[model samples]
Target: MALPRTAPSSWMQSLDLPSQLFETGSTDYELYEEDDEFVLSVELPGFDPEEITASWDDGVLDIAAEHDDQQRGERRTYHRRFRFPKSVADEEITAEYTNGILEVRLPVEEAVVSGREIEIES
Candidate 1:
């Protein structure tokens, strides 16, 4: 006889490897709001420093990393996109990775007008 399925007691508790610790399509991360900055922490195991990259455009933050073992014929990748708050300085965002963890610091700044009035030529 088959046992009935039961709901998980926790949001992030599971027996599966890797998947239990992070989402399937992207890496796992935690967001924190501080008095001066917004912190974003991401877990990227088995990735090298050169393989990682980060960028921001139009208030959207994008992070990605990839590694390949040619002899082992294995490839691993992580990609995540975060829409930063309008109150934060998207252009000033910075990131650092250590011990398989990536921490991004985004200092909040007053919103400034990025547009300027243009004069039309006759």
Candidate 2:
């Protein structure tokens, strides 16, 4: 005999089930410093370039996207903010979206680490 389908538990129903289940893994975005610039690449599969926006304020870079499908009655949104370790030239920042991937490049100002290296105990 087959088991009958039942409703979810009260606690489960109260959770953001869809988001938790459908969200991408932590590896969906990559950030790194290279060639005097901070590079960020994020995978946003279902959104179009027109629906995506990127902005820099102070030391934070904000990336957001929204998509709406009237026929399917569905809406999706993505938002993320990143703070760079070094000063960024906000005016030189640039972004590009292609092949469902959004790439943002932030030119970092002259930032050199000046600290003493601590010896580790064997």
Best-performing candidate as measured by lDDT:
2
Candidate 2 ranges beyond 4 A from true positions: 1-25, 111-122
lDDT of 1 by residue, 14-61 (tens): 555555455445537998888789899999988988999988877777
What shift in Å separates residue 28 of candidate 2 from its native position after superposition?
1.9
**Which residue pairs clash in candidate 2?**
none
- lDDT at residue 10 of model 2 (Cα atoms): 40
Q: For model 1, name the residue pairs that clash.
A: none
lDDT tens digits, residue span 38-121, model 2: 999999998989999999888999999999999999999999898887799889999999899999999988767799999999
Error of 2 at 9 (Å): 18
Best by TM-score: 2
Summing lDDT over every window of 10 consecutive residues in candidate 2, give the lowest-scoring window. 3-12
